[model samples]
Target: MGRAIALGLPLLVVAEIAVFVLVGSWIGYPWAVLAVLAASFAGLMLLRREGMRAWRGFIAAANSGQHPGERVIDGIVGLGAGVLLTVPGFVTALTGLVLLFPPTRSVARRGVQRWTERRVSSAVAGDLFGPRKVRVRRGAPDVDGAIEGEIVEPR
Candidate 1:
């Protein structure tokens, strides 16, 4: 992921810049600027709305003694959208707008959840039982008809 980010960020920046220039050329520069501004403003409004909704849902879930995971996830995604919208770029703004919408946000939420789960599982698996190894001996006794193994202490 880190390597992908290292490579992708530069390409993303170049693509965004090229898009901006092309848009500016197609429509007058002033109009292009206005369009970007308008998109940002709209995104901000969407961010605020989604943020409020997520907050309210969180509060309601908490008050009702229910798990707030979904609400919290929504709030986090909305916050991300707000940040992206705040950034002065068309690509980020469009991405933010997509995250602001419920259908798109749900898709993004699932992706985020899956990514988080994978990261957490890997982290847990990495530090399991303080570095241990399994050893299979040729004469090991079987237990309950299951293959037997032993933990090999570090030499």
Candidate 2:
């Protein structure tokens, strides 16, 4: 994953530059610059709005005795979308816009949840989202009783 990100960042930058140049050529440089500025402004507004909404949702979920993982994940996705839009790139702005919608946001949230579950330990995940079904196996007990042992100090 780290390697992919290392390579992907440069590629993304190149793609963004290419797209910007293409759009500028078609619509004129000034319009393209204005569009980028507009996108950045929109992104800032979205970030503020989503931040408030997420905080409210988190508080409501907690107060209602519901798991807050979903709301927390929603906030994470919203923040990601806002950051993506803030970055000066059309492709990222498009992606951020897609994530702003409810349906797409839900999908993104689910994907993030799955990715996190895979990366995080079950115990930790459970702690965050409450108890989850997990498989357990019993190991055979040691047949030999406790062995005599002494801690020796190293010189």
lDDT of 2 by residue, 39-66 (tens): 9989998899889888999999889888
Q: Mind giving the per-residue lDDT tens digits that candidate 1 earns over 59-147?
A: 89878876665676777788889878876678888888788788998888767754554566534422321334668767756676666
Q: After aligning candidate 2 to the native by TM-score, how far in Å is the CA of 141 from where it should be?
A: 16
Which runs of model 1 end up more than 4 angstroms from their true locations?
120-155
Backbone clash pairs for candidate 1 read none
| Backbone-clash count (model 1) | 0
* Candidate with the greatest TM-score versus the true structure: 2
In the predicted model 2, the residue pairs found to clash are none
